[model samples]
Target: MAPSTTLYPRATLKKIVKAHSNRPLTKNVDILVFLNYTLFLQELMKEASIKSKQSGERGISARSVRRVREHCLRKFKG
Candidate 1:
């Protein structure tokens, strides 16, 4: 199997979670949260790109992202 590479800094994720949570987290928890966050961004970008294309835009815009944000959230809802 190939090695896994992180797109964002693990330290930054740790800091963000640390600030919000009162309890300490294990390293695996940090990795899981990082992975989920990355996946959320990927899904959001894909939806935004499709929205932009439908509107004849060359790139994803903030408006496109805003339009699809709720859809993405609903799809990812647990």
Candidate 2:
């Protein structure tokens, strides 16, 4: 029998589904979701599609990234 080859933790299971899709995501939401949920690229795509509008893309800075990362790590890092 072969051992499982998955590398990501179970907390990241949602991401595998996301990445399977070929559609790409905008960078703004990409950073936000990753900073907050460590979710897969596809989940970020779903989030952005629902939340974003015709505007080019949201501007996200390093400070905001750090803040979100901290919040996720503290709140959802379980």
Candidate 3:
């Protein structure tokens, strides 16, 4: 299998977390940690759905994407 490429670099993620630190609420902090990943996945699903539509295939599901997003948020919550 090929190596996985990182969508967000460590420094970028650190910056996001740092920026959100100003708020310091539990919900905001949780969003700060998982925002990048959630956004990435959402974009990925959007693209995949578009491509699938072009190819006349079934597209990605919004419900499934939400479930995945919630799972990540829960996993990253401290």
Best-fitting candidate, measured by lDDT?
1
Q: Candidates' lDDT values, in order?
A: 0.87, 0.46, 0.59
**Distance (Å) between predicted and true CA of 26, model 2?**
34
Give the number of the best model, judged by TM-score: 1
Residue pairs with backbone overlap in model 1: none
Per-residue lDDT over 1-78 for candidate 3, one digit per residue giving the tens place of the 0 to 100 score: 787685446566566766867754443444455676677666657665665566566756665455355555564455
* Candidate 2 residue lDDT tens string, 22-47: 56645354445544554543444444
Instruction: Give the better candidate number (1 or 2) by lDDT.
Output: 1
TM-scores of all models?
Answer: 0.66, 0.27, 0.37
Clashes of each: 0, 2, 0
Clashes of 2: 2
Off by over 4 Å in 3: 1-31, 61-78
Residues 27-78, model 1: lDDT tens digits: 7777788667788899999999999999999999999999999999887765
Error of 3 at 6 (Å): 24
Residue 39 of model 1, lDDT score? 88
Greater-lDDT candidate between 2 and 3? 3
